[model samples]
Target chain A: DVKVTQSSRYLVKRTGEKVFLECVQDMDHENMFWYRQDPGLGLRLIYFSYDVKMKEKGDIPEGYSVSREKKERFSLILESASTNQTSMYLCASSLGGGPNTGELFFGEGSRLTVL
Target chain B: TQLLEQSPQFLSIQEGENLTVYCNSSSVFSSLQWYRQEPGEGPVLLVTVVTGGEVKKLKRLTFQFGDARKDSSLHITAAQPGDTGLYLCALWAAGNKLTFGGGTRVLVKP
Candidate 1:
């Protein structure tokens, strides 16, 4: 089975502190994404990477940034964490193109709480 | 930007009941997918409907894609406790980005 692993299952950080959430996929998928899931707003895309060193901003990219230094690893960076940033962060990977490109394989998710 | 909207944000019912969830969008999509997420877990893909006016079934669940490719629906029959979870609908947009809906939280009691 394809596996998407998130480094942390839960995290707590102080306001204004820098935060990093890591994700790795073993399937060698070409597209990786970071999304923040909230109660009523759904899963909003923060950033996505189509290649190892290429990244694109998504719908909600104001408070977050991303890095894809390696094909398998994608990291979400919060320059300065705030209370409003507390939410469930999900990482997903999928085939870059072709017939099955739309099917995403997701990680277990990292729940972060900023105090 | 294309947006997908799901209705009935929350639902509660007893086992053996039937229910249906709707997903609507103003823009046309190449395909639509349905996912279910349990507590503490990531959303799992349930079904994908690509053709206009297409219908597919997975056991007790039935999925339909609108003729215009702008909407979809998921119906569950004899829902069990295991069916309790958040159901999300996503659209496969142009840039290979999947635009997700807000989701419907379903709770089934025995």
Candidate 2:
């Protein structure tokens, strides 16, 4: 079975601190995404990478950035964490981009709490 | 904003009951996906309907996409306790960016 692993399941950080959330997919997928899911509001994409070292901003990308230095790993960085940035962060990967974009394989998710 | 509205934000019923969830939208979608997410875990893909007026079934669950591809529904026969989870509907737009419905949380009492 394909596996997507996340660095942390839960984390706590002070407001204004920098935070990192990592995701690694063993399927060699060409697309990786980071999203924050909040109650009432569905999963809103923050960033997505279609290839190594290439990233694109999604709908909500103001306070977040991403890095895809390796094919299997994608990282989401909180430049400066704020109380409003606390939410359930999810990382997902799809096999490829465009016409054949298959179902996304998701990590267990990381829940961050900014104090 | 491309929005998909899901009905019955929460549903709770006995194990043997039957239920149906609805997902509606005014704008058309090229494809629709259904996902079931357990608490604290990521959402898992249940099925996807691409063509208009398509119907698919997985065991006791039936999914149908509207003729115009602007709506969809999920029906479960003889619900089980294991079916209790969050059901999300997603629509794929032009840029591979998916818009998801508000999601329905179901609880099956045993």
Candidate 3:
């Protein structure tokens, strides 16, 4: 089974503070993604990495950046955390890109609270 | 922008009841997937429907993709308390990214 693990299950930060959320996958998947799940908004992609040191901005990438220094690790960085950024963040990894790659396996998710 | 729409944002029913959730889109997709997520947990894939008008069954749940590959539906038979969770429908649009629906929250009480 594919195991995707997040660094923190719960976190709290003050406004304007920097926040970092980490994700690691044991499956050595080539594709990794960061998403925020909000009520009525679903899971909106924030950023994704296809390979080491490679990143792509998704639909809502503002105020957020990503790092993929290694294949098993993907990190999400918030330049300046705001109250609006308080939400559940999820990380996912997929085996490869193709018709039969299967569904993405996600971590338990990190719940962030901005004060 | 391709959008996946879900109906009945919330549903509450007693055990032994049946319900159907819908996911619709205006654009075509290569495959559609159904997932169930609990609070504080990420969504988990339950079924994946690839062919147009294809139907797949998993235990007490059934998934169907539209003939045009623009829509999908999930039906649960004799839902139980253990079946309570948020259901999400996702689509693979040729690209690597998977677009997900708004999600439907279901609660089944015994």
Global lDDT scores for all candidate models: 0.92, 0.90, 0.90
Residue B83 displacement (Å), model 3 = 0.6
Query: Which digits, one per residue and each the tens of the lDDT, describe model 3 over residues A1-101?
Result: 77999999999999999999999999989999999999877788898888999998887899999999999999999989999999999999998766445
lDDT of 3 by residue, B31-74 (tens): 88888998778899998888999999999999999999888999
Q: Write the per-residue lDDT of candidate 2 for residues A1-115, one digit (tens) a residue.
A: 9999999999999999999999999999999989899886778889888899999888899999999999999999998999999999999998885842479888989999999
DockQ of 3: 0.62
Clashing residue pairs in candidate 2, if any? none
How many steric clashes does model 1 contain?
0
Residue pairs whose backbone atoms clash in candidate 1? none
lDDT string, candidate 1, B1-110, tens digits: 32988988999999999999999998888888999999999999998888899999999999999999888999999999999999999876655577799999999999
Q: Cα RMSDs of all predictions?
A: 1.5, 1.2, 1.4
After superposition, candidate 2 runs with Cα above 4 Å error: none
| Per-model TM against the reference | 0.96, 0.96, 0.96
- Could you give candidate 1's per-residue lDDT for residues A48-89 as a string of tens digits? 999999998988899898999999999999999999999999
Question: Model 1 misses residue A99 by how many Å?
Answer: 9.4
Ranked candidates, highest DockQ first: 3, 2, 1
